[model samples]
Target: MGMGGMRRQGSDFEPEFFRIFRSIEDQQKRSAWLQAEGMLAAAPMLRARGLPLAADDPGEVSLEAERAAAEQQMLEALVRSGVPFLLAGPSLAAWTLYPEPGRRPRESMDLMIHARAVNDARAILRDEDFVPDPRGATRTESAQAWRRSKASVQLSIRLRWDFCDHPILNRRFSIAGLQAKSVVIEKPVAGLRALGVEHATLYSALRWVDAVHERFRLVDLFDQDLRWRMLGKEKLAELALLARQRGVAGILAEHLGMARRVFGTPVSTELLHSLKQSGNHERSGSLLGAGRGRMRYHLLGALYGRGLRVRGRHLFSLISPG
Candidate 1:
């Protein structure tokens, strides 16, 4: 079919799709979703839980400076500890794909370390004065907090370090597999590092599916938008194939469909149609319901439970306030 005809056929639910897309794009809706998920506060919110910010100087400039210092210290500590690791999450996103100044600055840095080196890395973090936040962390134990010093910003900055070999959506993704497929590149500020754009993109898509299935969050949708913009037709084709191989074709197709309809994200019409044909019809219906509200999406998740395999514990971690 021609591209125009294909777009029409592919977007049969455009009205409902865009409605949901715009809702997620709305800042108020996004904030409400983050607040509901308990991720809205990075460090300042943790003050009540004993990890106080620089109470005397809580200005944005101070906070930004502290965060920058903390990130540099954390990276230095990781290197000093001799632990093999790769940067992921928003920091990496900023480094590689989305360089928009208006994009929200990440609250923490996410690092994936070799499984065997996790203990050593943890020890290094502890020596650096970093401690576990234990707020929203569940299956994968992510470390947070450094020290409570006025000079160091009082442990306000947080870092999440996870073992490279871990389960995402209940599926195992090994570090070796990641390293083999990841694109190695040099960062202007951070030097040479592995940029797992493909893996990160796929992971973001899966996270978005989980958000729809559990609680609707704007950050997840925003992440999808960022990663989607970073990828091209070749990369997306590879990602689609990876999702199929990883048993997440339905989930990928559903979110890609939503992104295409809402953000006008670039996705091949042919690719979308093929994925939809191979994916679950139930999920397609759920995606349509998701644009309406949380209740509809939850009902669909309860009814279908197909497409992606999100562990019960993982689902709890996504929704639970940490």
Candidate 2:
């Protein structure tokens, strides 16, 4: 189902927000889960509407300062190690959403750095006591035990990836490529770096499609919506052109439509119409559109990519298996 069809009656967030909310029968368990997701602030609103509530719910505890310090520590370590990185996904989104992470806490910070720096980044994070949770079988992990599911966003494992969703998306896109074409945004923290208006907007849409198609997580849509609202019309025009150049504008338009419909985010309708006009050139709807088997994701990838090269490069991306 598209996001609209997935909504349960009471959820103001993603449908899985309520799907997981309703699944827990115990009040404190629900409260704890909400606290962990950073949604405990909604407790009063939910209770006023006569939903279940725990009378003894704890006082609001903000994790922003602590998270900021931890993020600073890790980034400093990476920079010291000479590894260039981009604060990616939730970590990148946190800069604008500062002092409030909205409905979900960034249980893990995301980093997408040069492919050459993966091992060094992994080691630096480990030295800082950030345990690396390396996952490669995106093509093989089961649905019920899928580690990235909405219900299991945090497993008390405190897991973090050395590279931001790299195993899944880095296979398709690259940090160096993004850095080459992208403008840099202001560093939120001392060592923090990210793509500026144009590139950040493009990448977030790309990630949004991958996350939703895999049924992996709704939080990514929140990230995309965050980027969309920050990029006003002119920059978005730049994004639309960049996306078409990248061959993802068509599929991105459809997913951006989902972000708009669900979050009431201010994505331009005219821009979306322009994006959809790409038609056959848009690669994702055929390549990674939802429900295709894993084998097809690998096969179709070789057929096209942003800024196509000779077939050999595409074939290398398919078989090299990051």
Candidate 2 similarity to native, TM-score: 0.63
lDDT of 1 by residue, 1-322 (tens): 0112224435344533234424576665654544443234333322433432333223443454455555666666666556777676655664555332113345556666555776777677667666665542433333343342334454333333432212334333566566566664554334435547778876566545433323443444556665887777788778877777765676677677666654456666778778766666433434433264444444444443333442343444345453
- Give candidate 1's root-mean-square deviation (CA, Å): 10.2
- Model 2, residue pairs in steric clash: none
**Cα lDDT of all candidates, in order?**
0.51, 0.52
C-alpha TM-score for every candidate: 0.61, 0.63
What lDDT is reached at residue 239 by model 1? 81
Total clashes for model 2: 0
- Where in model 2 is the C-alpha error above 4 Å? 1-65, 101-104, 134-174, 181-188, 212-217, 288-322
Give the C-alpha miss distance for residue 315 in model 2, angstroms: 16
Candidate 2 local distance difference test against the native: 0.52
Candidate 1 accuracy as TM-score: 0.61
